[model samples]
Target: MSNKPLTYLAFIILVLGGGLLIGANTMPGDWYQSLAKPAFNPPNWVFAPVWSILYVLIGVVGARTWLAFRRSMAMRLWFAQLVLNFAWSPLFFGLRDPMSAMIVILGLLVSIIGFIAASWRQDRTAALLFLPYLAWIAFASALNAAILVLN
Candidate 1:
């Protein structure tokens, strides 16, 4: 009776469920609506679906890292990025501080890149799984920077 499936399930729930819970609690609301957005700003409706998909990928990658590299730098970066990821919405929307959110997002971006690099040789599949996440975060970091400049 391998517990691997249960481990995968738990990791998926942790990442996806936690992200959704945090997102629900930190809805942008009227405050974000008031901000001067960049021309590239995505419609509000695009966020949920994108994040839902990304979170699932993130969860799977996270589980793979956990199972193979629990004591490695990839695992540490995974945790670091998750904390930063979970903090971004609250700092940005809930506290209405784009500056802090930008900082957090930058940290998240760095941690994500570090995770990819760390896991590349050790767990190439895990590293590969993070590519879309990397691209999205890069776009998001740009968006965060644009909002900071615009507003």
Candidate 2:
């Protein structure tokens, strides 16, 4: 457990978390508040904390995978998913298009699954770390679909 890898991990985590924070800061504002939400919609306050946890988990998984496998396909998929994750907020909130956001989420879900599958052989811990992320994204996909339908 060298401090070097840990340092890299911390840097990766901060970068990923920063992206999430930037997205979160771009509040949907009145446009989002006026939308017809589904019955299951979580309160607006729920997103920040949940996403914060998920981003940290994602960063951990990324660090582990990178430490173990460098720029492997699993790492690539992880990066791909992160990019898609970053894209969702702007599309859904900034652009105010739930439909397009749903599309991005779908891609994110696929990338996440791919990352998990690829990471499973390389590092089970890393793969396992993604499970909660997968679950959350699944829930998010459903939420996006519901918003598209309701709005």
Candidate 3:
């Protein structure tokens, strides 16, 4: 097998598997259930499918960026966002600190935008792939803010 396929596979597994592990460990439990939520808060069932798709898209973008521009700003932003992405769940669900989670998510959103802007000239497809994830996270950021206000 060529290095390209292996790189894609490795990144997909890294992103998707890491997301699954973090999600499984940081599942919303009674603490989350007890907290007040915004009216627009999505149902529990909605998160899995949305995140699953986003993770794949993220993985693909990461792989493409790694292959084409390993040391570029886009790659750095990708790593930065992944760290923030992985941290949000634990901070919000495991530690049950919406305030800290909110901070991390804002940084995540910025890093995502940075990635898109950095990738736009070099790889439009990779940049486009991130649009849905951006929209979802933007919604999630609003939802997070609403939850903080409500509760």
Candidate 4:
């Protein structure tokens, strides 16, 4: 394998993280507190640390997958899911539309499944990397659905 620097991976993380922070900021105080949360709603503090790690994983796997394939269809799906993942922040936090956000999360979930399939078809590790992300989003989607139903 070539020894190309993984600088772009860090850049990807930075881009996703920056957008997440900005989106999270758009929510005013008590934004989460007032929501019709579920029994499994993670503690407020859990979000930042968890998301930080997840974002880094995302970037690394994405970079690895991209590097492995010069121009594969899976590579394109990887990006499509990334965009959808990034879009969730604004739809949920920035707009404060739980219902709309739920819908976005559904799309995000579907795209993630597609992305993982693409990742798995080419690179197993890349697919493995997204497992935690997929699990988390699945739980989050459940929470979103619950919130929408109760609220």
> Candidate 2 — which pairs collide?
none
Superposed by TM-score, candidate 4 places the C-alpha of residue 119 at a distance from the truth, in angstroms, of: 2.0
lDDT of 2 by residue, 14-82 (tens): 756677676767787999889888888898789878887787778777777777787799988988997
Rank by lDDT (best first): 3, 1, 2, 4
Per-model CA lDDT versus the true structure: 0.93, 0.84, 0.95, 0.76
Off by over 4 Å in 4: 1-3, 7-12
**How close to the true structure is residue 37 of candidate 3, measured as C-alpha lDDT?**
92
Looking at model 1, which ten-residue stretch has the lowest summed lDDT?
60-69
Tens-place lDDT per residue, model 4, 1-151, is: 5544555556466656665776566653577577777788787788777878778788777777667774877677767777777777677777778888888888878877887887686788888988998999899899889988878
Candidate number with the higher lDDT (1 or 3): 3
- Give the clashing residue pairs of candidate 4, or none: none
- Report how far residue 73 has shifted in candidate 4, in Å: 2.2
Q: Which whole-number lDDT from 0 to 100 does residue 119 have in model 3?
A: 97
